[model samples]
Target: MTYSLQTKSIQCPYCGEQIEVIVDCSVNNQEYVEDCSVCCKPIIFSVASFQGEVVSIEAHTEDE
Candidate 1:
């Protein structure tokens, strides 16, 4: 079944800036890194979802 999920607003670990990220749980668990909009530094995000509800969120920097 296809499902639509609301995007989440997260803070960039490097610059502490706000950003919007869309999460799709219907596909599966996901992990990726994106640049901070304000600082241009890389921020890693790890998300887990089950039954269309966010189960866990882990955000960290490369040095962390």
Candidate 2:
């Protein structure tokens, strides 16, 4: 499988800061974690993609 990287801007659920995230477009649907750039808190990511394109994305805090 090819690794396709897609960049997305999302608001941090914790600090409400806009952050850029790199998504793996090769995956159809994926859930992952990443730290916030501003707050350094763990972020939960829900990503949806199809055929190397991102359909939708959602960001949440660790508890949410």
Model 2 residue 32 distance off true place after TM-score fit, in angstroms: 0.5
Tens-place lDDT digits, model 2, residues 12-52: 99999999999999989999999999999999999999989
True-structure RMSD for candidate 2: 0.8
lDDT of 1 by residue, 1-64 (tens): 6885868888888777778877777655888887777787888889888878777777789998
What is the Cα-based lDDT of residue 18 in candidate 2? 94
Top candidate when judged by lDDT against the true structure: 2
Give the distance in Å from residue 17's predicted Cα in candidate 2 to where it truly belongs. 0.7
**TM-score on alpha carbons, each prediction:** 0.75, 0.94
C-alpha-based local distance difference test score of model 2: 0.93
- Model 2 stretches with alpha carbons more than 4 Å out: none
lDDT of 2 at 33: 94
Q: What is the C-alpha lDDT of each candidate?
A: 0.79, 0.93
